[model samples]
Target: MSDICVIIAAYNAEATIAQAVTSALAEAEVAEVVVVDDASSDATAEAALAASDGSGRLIVERQAQNGGPSAARNRAVALSQAPRIAILDADDFFLPGRFARLDPDLDLAADNIVFVTPEHAARLDPTNLPAAPREVEMLDAERFALGNLAQGVHRGELGFLKPVMSRAFLTRHGLRYDERMWLGEDFDLYMRMLLLGARFGLTRAVGYAAVQRGASLSGRHRTADLAALEACCRAHLEMPASPATQEAMRRHLRQVQAKLLLRQFLDRKAEAGLGAALGFALAPPARFLPIAKGVARDKIAALRPPAPPRAERFLLPV
Candidate 1:
């Protein structure tokens, strides 16, 4: 068994799966690499097999039916016997000598390493806007939590927790991606792991290259995706949390979901017409007033500073 098992979930990724698998195999700490093909219409499995060069170290499993990436991931993880597991999208690649940079003693450390793209670039948004990469040092649990909150508030990005995790820690906490969620399943898993008291470690080295293509998962948007995100937020609120922490999480979720909804509304407005988009957008909010109120109230409450003028209530136009 390898010290680490790298799992890649592929669907119609023939053009990129080979490079991704090769990168995983090149990882010094990765003893085994598994590729799960989710009934791809393309020759993704064939490409992965060819990349493995008949090496038994690489295993490919083709699902009989079409399952989502989360299901593929769960299947891959179940087949692996490694103590550590890292997931890379089929289009993404790992940096050279990346696994060598990971500390062997990391046991749920809260210091997730900074991610650098394949071009040695950093992105501030999921859209892959270029930015300078900063080295993140080790941080205590509370500090890391605060960092997550800060990032969520300022950058609209959640910085705590990641998909790459210790298998032992995952099993211990029964952490798994929500297969039902078509989008934001990773976020849900990450947040739950954090709530479960998982530790993290940070490395300045960029271990993985996240492929930023127009067709990538994060690039696509749909009404189902929006619904999934809202459901995730509701689930987070249902999780056991202190009043302050719950309020912060709820605020972050609402803002993020609102942003997504607004984006979709604008997109539809651009394509069809503003009238149609407004009707579409307003329908959900109208039917879900109580839910929207809870989210909006939490968001507004969290924005207030230690002391503020009473008139500051009007500052939030949400």
Candidate 2:
């Protein structure tokens, strides 16, 4: 258990599974690569077999029946014996030094891998690169979580974009991806980790190359997706937090519910949609205290000259 185990959940990814396996094997920090095939009715398994460099560490588990990404990943993790698990979708590959960039620092120091399309990954010249996984910055926990989930409560970005969870940490908490959820399962896992006080920081490295992107199977199930998303939001609202954080969660819930109502009208979804609409419609409005005693006093701050700009920008382009 001294090395990292790379887990890849591949489904009907015959065309890209090879590169993914190869990439994982390329990582010096990776001791083994587990590729779980979700009963693909194609050559996904065969491609994985063909792609192996015969290091005897690439374990390919081909399921008998089609289960889902969650089930596939769970199976892979169950068979692995590494302390850290780095996940890669079949259509994604680890950029060089991905494993090298990721460091172990208890619950923090996770990787900061970027998602690059197939076309995007092809233009780089291996001979003259800035070196794989160049570390750049650290991330704030709450801010990272909020920004990661900015897309939606059930969606996340950077902090969790490429999770490399500590095996001991997960096992101790009895935590695993929600197999029941067809979509937003990652969101659920991240939220649960955050609630339980998992502090995630960035390696500012371990960038990976995602060969392709498209709508997920759950994306087509708008009703189910929204329901899952709402469940995620409610879970957040129930968690202990400061007044400001709770208010932000409330505002997010309102926005989600409003959309659920409209989707219900167009898709004629189940009772869930109607319930969300009613919940938002009947919710009380929020009030905030004024910052200043006088309007003129408030305007004084706004009228002041802007602070001097720094040469270094606060945000880095992803």
Candidate 3:
């Protein structure tokens, strides 16, 4: 079987599909590249086909109907023949030596690799990037709970949103993307995989280039999306938390909820404002207080400046 199968989900990504496919094909370890077009109305399929030309390894599939990305990805993974599978959005491209950089242990076994992008790249900025240097390591149940809890709290930074996974592990755990969740599906799947005792490999290398654009799913904010994130948080919390982990989970959930609330309040859209307010009002009273406190702390943190030397601080006191 092929060492790795790269799956790309496309929907009106004509502008970048070729580059993405070409990059995937460039990876020496990637045995095949599969592009699933979710019934795009644009020339995405055509572009993918053109990119695949002369590369007999490229397989282009089209959905009969316009399903969302999660569904499209599921369809592509089901058809993938490789032992390991890497997922990339149509608008994203992998850097050279991506597969070569992955942990050899993971490369040979049924493990997952979490590849992180560079710091200044607009697509996946380092400030919001997850822990890096894709190395495989075992995780205990408690560790998994805490790790996922921390990830939920810092979802924007953990960047566990999406990563390369082993098809064998997925099959063993029956792990698949939730077709119902359009937003944060990657988070959901990753959390579930962790709960299933999947090992992790972290890499600082920017193997993938994620294009930041207005039409991206993450670019759009909706009440349903926040609700989905909250639901994902709740799911992670229910995964048998230890006492310490439980407290951590609660704190993380409160912070996440508060951030969502703030986002809702600041949203210019009237409907989103109403929804955010309603969501905040419906949250548990105990949690609301913590959420508010967390919000205030975050605001203060944002306002604070960097620390200076003691002597300099006295000499140039602000």
What's the lDDT for all of these models?
0.65, 0.65, 0.64
lDDT at 27, model 1: 68
Q: What is the C-alpha RMSD of each candidate to the true structure, in Å?
A: 9.9, 9.4, 8.1
Better of 1 and 2 by TM-score: 2
TM-score of each: 0.71, 0.74, 0.71
For model 3, the superposed segments whose C-alpha errors exceed 4 Å read 107-156, 160-162, 259-318
Least accurate stretch of 10 residues (summed lDDT) in model 1? 309-318
Q: Write the per-residue lDDT of candidate 3 for residues 254-310, one digit (tens) a residue.
A: 655765665554452355565665465446554456555655876897898954312
Total backbone collisions for each predicted model: 10, 0, 6
Model 3 pairs whose backbones collide: 133-202, 133-203, 133-204, 134-202, 134-203, 135-202
Query: Please, what's the RMSD in Å of model 2?
Result: 9.4
Clashing pairs in 1: 108-199, 108-200, 109-199, 109-200, 109-201, 110-199, 110-200, 111-200, 111-201, 111-202
Off by over 4 Å in 2: 126-141, 149-156, 215-221, 251-259, 269-318
Q: Candidate 2: deviation at residue 174, Å?
A: 1.0
Q: Rank the candidates by TM-score, best first.
A: 2, 1, 3
lDDT of 1 by residue, 25-71 (tens): 87667878999999999999999999984557899999999878789
